[model samples]
Target: MSEYRAGKAGINAEAQARINSKYNDEIAQETLEWIQKITGSPANTAGDAENLYEVLKDGTLLCHLVNKFQEGSVKKINQSTMAFKCMENINAFLEAVKKLGVPSQETFQTIDLWEKQNLYSVVVCLQSLGRKAGNFGLPSMGPKESERNVREFSEDQLKAGQNVISLQYGSNKGQQSGISFGNRRQI
Candidate 1:
């Protein structure tokens, strides 16, 4: 007798299609071109999600790309085809990019690329890295990252802000609902 097994819980088809719809072929193509220019080699794949995944799933190119931004950022790039080895390379690339000023939130998890679960997220991470590349004096692919804008206030300004009540605390003007709470209805 065969034992019964349950299907894995994961994203539904509609949700997956929604995510896939958000993936822009143009952006992916540009990102691939940028990677090729930086790495000095062709990616040898079309910019679609499936092709991009096949090209980058191993993570070798990602490690190479990060190293171009910062010399020796990823100390060891795995060359094996083993699952864990590829994941290690992806993780290493993520860590190296994080050190190079790419925010952790902007980076993709290994499984996202490894399993092809969310290729759009991978493209987003690459685009973020490309934007961060501007800090290294390299040509950026997408929109440039915004610089930090910090403001300081004097002691008087701080005190004035504390004393003033902002209009955001909207005035109720004693308005009340006609209905009463915790009261029984008379038949």
Candidate 2:
């Protein structure tokens, strides 16, 4: 905790930040690996707080705290799935911002500056947390989060026989025709 006058980073806080940097990464990475094994889900900061708030509009500088599932004060990833972890992360981040006592309802708040200044420290610690063991990708969205395949086709696609529906009878010419509801007029 030296009193070096690091720019922007205050003197006292800078020392503590460096000291924290020493061990936080080692522990965080270990936890991340453990989380990956039990749940088979990677510690991904892929949504909401990490995505919207932590990240820059140009998709740069994602904040570390945004990854609540992995890096939150509360443990999120485990054998049990947290369906509400996204909201939890968002609330956690916003609550932290509010606690900062910055009264504003716009983009680029004090929190952004707070996060940016401390981002490297947090990121080093988090990245030091390292990745989970296996090359696991995102977890399955489960039945609720899974998307249903649409069985619709335009007139052209239908006749294209992407999915051919054969209707053959005993004595009929081998022919295929798409069902169409053509406009008909009667006199």
Off by over 4 Å in 1: 1-11, 43-45, 177-187
Best by TM-score: 1
Q: What lDDT tens digits, residue by residue, belong to model 1 across residues 7-81?
A: 334567678677778888788888888888888655464688777887798899999999889899998999999
| Steric clashes per prediction | 0, 1
- Candidate no. 2 TM-score: 0.23
Q: What does each candidate score in C-alpha RMSD?
A: 4.6, 20.9
| lDDT string, candidate 2, 32-135, tens digits | 44434444444453432233223322211222233423344333322212324433443344444333332234223232323443333333322322232122
Residue 105, model 2, lDDT: 41
